[model samples]
Target: MTVVIGFEGSANKIGIGIIRDGEVLSNPRRTYITPPGQGFLPSETARHHRAVILTVLQEALEQAGLKPADVDCVAYTKGPGMGAPLVTVALVARTVAQLWGKPLLGVNHCIGHIEMGRLITHADNPTVLYVSGGNTQVIAYSERRYRIFGETIDIAVGNCLDRFARVIKISNDPSPGYNIEQMAKKGSQYVELPYTVKGMDVSFSGILSYIEEAAHKMLESGQCTAEDLCFSLQETLFSMLVEITERAMAHCGSQEVLIVGGQLFVIKSCRFFFSNLTIFLFSKSVEFHRFCIDNGAMIAQAGWEMFRSGHVTELPDSWITQR
Candidate 1:
């Protein structure tokens, strides 16, 4: 079986993973948690990755009981992410590949998530709902490509949630989204938020703006608690996600839906939506947190797939992009 080591520092998390064929041998990651009322900065996040990536890589190798020489290839996320973070991980991957004399693969971040979801859940040809801090899209495989059927016109869903969390000063230890989800469970009131979905795309900036203003007014007037606002935001946004996913499913004529990305963790908790569809939620239990957030295992898996398909990237072609 082909062995691969993957690096992922797309946003706030820095991860290293080792995989053999489709099986993940090790997955180690660290998230850069900013304080309440703040969001992650690319420079700071990149510095965090640069500081801890080697430690994370060593831990992954130790966990897998493998040496640098044992790995057949090295992979790193190449695009659709924060530039500084992506470049940080890419430099590390390139250094490791050079040191070990291993082939290097530049993987599309979105494709990595989709490939890992497919590997973990074995959901063939399913409509995909890819939601994360940096991305939100409904995708389907067509002619060897994951085509975007729908997407966000403005900020991503997770970004909106994170920014909203900042408005209410929520903890960012694990994630702003997870904290919101927990607080929402305690919420009994539902505040109305704007819902904007135009054709196949969704927009979150308007909703985010509206909620920020409403939360401020409500807090000032003693009309609502943070929990109530969190609950309302989750309900409104997740309902929109469910609606769009169903629309994509209907258009693609697929019975199975694969939910992947950091936001999938929150979405999976929406039992009301899963009950209505044949949903294949990846990394549901095993390493649930790792898979839910961006991790090296997905990158390793995607890289290995590309290697098997005879794809390799030279150092000259290893530039990063934020699409």
Candidate 2:
């Protein structure tokens, strides 16, 4: 069986995973969480990765019951992420590959998500809705490449949620977005936030600014609770996402829709939309959700795809893209 070990340190999270012929053998990760109202900087995130990367890598190997000799290939996320963190991961991946005498591969972060989603769900030719702190995209597979049909024009939906969470001083222990999702469950009022969807593209900067100001003014004046603002933001942003996703699906004539990324809370936010569209939840279990998030197994899976397709990265070309 083809065995691949993958490294991912794209943002605040660092992870390593091992996969053997489409099956995940081990996946371990650590998050670098900042205090409430504070966001993680690239330098700090990279330092965090540097501190714990080797430990996590050991854990992945032990959990997978594999030795360095058994690994045939080494893989890592190559870009569209924070610069320092991406460089940190690339350095480790390159070192490991040379040490083990294995071929090295650089995988695209977005393509990793799509590959893992397809592998786990076994969905053929489904339209993909990828939402995360850094990216929001509606994609479809065509001509051997994942094509972006719709996307966020300004800020990503998850970034919007995170910033709003900071504005309201929500805890960032696990993530600001998760805290916002929890608070939104208790919300009953709709504060009528701005809804901006242009054709297949969505914009969140305007709505985020509007809500941030409204939250400060209304919460101080006893006009609305934090939960109400969270609810309103989730509803408005998710509706925009749903709108563009539906448009992409219709345009692609796809019957299956796969949602992948850190923000799977879109399910609770847009459950009603599912009734009209054929949506695949992948799985409702916690493992499924974890797999959907940023992780190394996805990168390994994508690397396995590329390796089988006759792709490899030379030592000199394994650079990262920090877009």
Candidate 3:
């Protein structure tokens, strides 16, 4: 019977949400989108979060039919995200907690995604693939901690896709990854790209470098289209992801797989391509879209879980982490 309000701005998106008893009451978020050939800077992203946070907070409260005084706790992402953005959201959370005379809780950004996915799918314990702009990991829960079975060695898959989109000058209206997915649908040829998987981990920097060179050559020689490049890149990278995920599943002995984060939408076309894997695509669920990204509802839910488990941050102990 706890009512928690969460704020999340760990990256480019700013979100506000309310949750009660493991159920999301309201989740509202906004992303800071840049133009073609541009990447989001931390300072600019933080500014966007600061600008729209109050409005989003108001909307979330209204949607939840609750007032600030009704909230029992305030939660916010503590880290593993951009410093400026994380600090911005943390500051807001601290302010809200103080103003409302509510307890404050700091949540891990990655765990927030996992907990929200599990809450939505009701999968007892599933192997998780957490893919986002800044993170890529295959995780499993054991002994109360989420252990990383496989992860990226270098750049994250989503970051690589975003950089590739910049090379091709794709619009960032919705997202670069979404644009790449759409363009990849038109591709008929599978241009070979490097696939680097080291043991349980994968690497994407080399692939990104190779694709940048290929893109330049294609543009110069008029031999290949951007769509073809997008298609080939998606095929190669997604195959690597599936392969590693399968290996983790086999090792962990889990039949259900939960996928979370913004990049999940990019690989929706290949969802059924994995054989024998009962993928509980959390992002596909109608009510779970906001939780898929770095949103406040996930933070609130995770924080509430921690709170119920008797975990809370004292006023002087509030902090943020980059790892």
Candidate 4:
């Protein structure tokens, strides 16, 4: 079995995956746990990426029982990621490729998420809804490229969640979505938040501000706990996203929809968004949960797919240092 190593450390989480003939052998992710009320800082995230990437790569190789010599190729996310973090992963990948004289392939991070979703869900030619800290788009593969049919004109889904979590004083955790998911599960009372949808693209910036205003009003009025407002906020934003995704799917003439990104782990926070879709929701669940986040495995998967399709050339030095 031909083995390949992929590197992912574009933003906050560092991920490494080992693939054998397009099948994942190991997928691992780790986040630099930020203190309460703090979203990821680029420099801090890059520092963390440098600290942990080697360990992850080694562990992934061990899981596959393959050494650097045994691997045939190395893949890394090329662009559309943080510059410093991307450089760290790229340096490692280029060094590894040079050392083993293995082919090094670079891939797009956005496309990696989409291809990984397709690979895991087997959702052939379906519309993809990618929601992450940096992105939220309704996309479809056509004419040799993944096209974004619908997306956020403003803030990304995960960013909205993180910002909202900060307002509610709950950002000590690695993922704000997880914290919001827990809060959403705890309380009641419908505080109708802003519902803004601009055609196929949605905007969450206004909603984030609205949720904060409502929460503050509730506190001043002494009507509800922070948890109640959190519940309402989750419900409102998720509803808006679902509405847009369902509409995009309809527009693309696809009944199949695949959800990809780290935020999907808090299914509780977003599953309700998909409640209105009448078609069968094919799970885009990867072979490993860690691959769900931004990481190396996703890049590798995309690279391997591109390579098999004869779309790539070995260039260890070709790296996307920035978006």
lDDT digits (tens) for residues 183-292 of candidate 3: 88898888888989898899999999999988988867877788899889988887888778878877986766777876634455444334323352222221211226
Q: What are the clash counts of all predictions, listed in order? A: 0, 0, 0, 5
Error of 3 at 266 (Å): 3.7
Candidate 3: where is the Cα deviation over 4 Å?
A: 270-291
What is the per-residue lDDT of model 2 for residues 1-323, given as tens digits with 9 covering 90 to 100?
Answer: 89999898898889998999999999999999899999889999999999999999999999999999999899999988999999999999999999999999999998888889888888777888888889999999999888999999998888998898889889887778778888988999999988998998999999999988888899999888999888888777777776787777668867677888866455454454454343433233211111267899999999998998899999899999987
Better of 1 and 4 by TM-score: 1
- How much is 300 displaced in model 1, in angstroms? 0.4
TM-score of 2: 0.94
* Candidate-wise lDDT, in order: 0.85, 0.85, 0.84, 0.75
Candidate 1 lDDT tens digits, 1-323:
89999899899988999889788999999988899989989999999998999899999999999999899999999988999999999998999999999999999999999899888878878888888998989899989788999999999999999999999899887888888988888999999888888888999999999998788889889898889998899888877887788788778767677778866345546464464333433322211211367899999999999999999999999889998
**Lowest-scoring 10 consecutive residues by lDDT in candidate 4?**
282-291
Segments in model 4 whose C-alpha atoms lie over 4 Å from true places: 172-174, 264-266, 279-291, 313-317
In model 1, pairs of residues that clash are: none
The global Cα lDDT (0 to 1) of model 2 is: 0.85
Against the true structure, what is every candidate's RMSD? 3.7, 3.5, 3.6, 3.6
Model 3: residue 77 alpha-carbon error in angstroms = 0.4
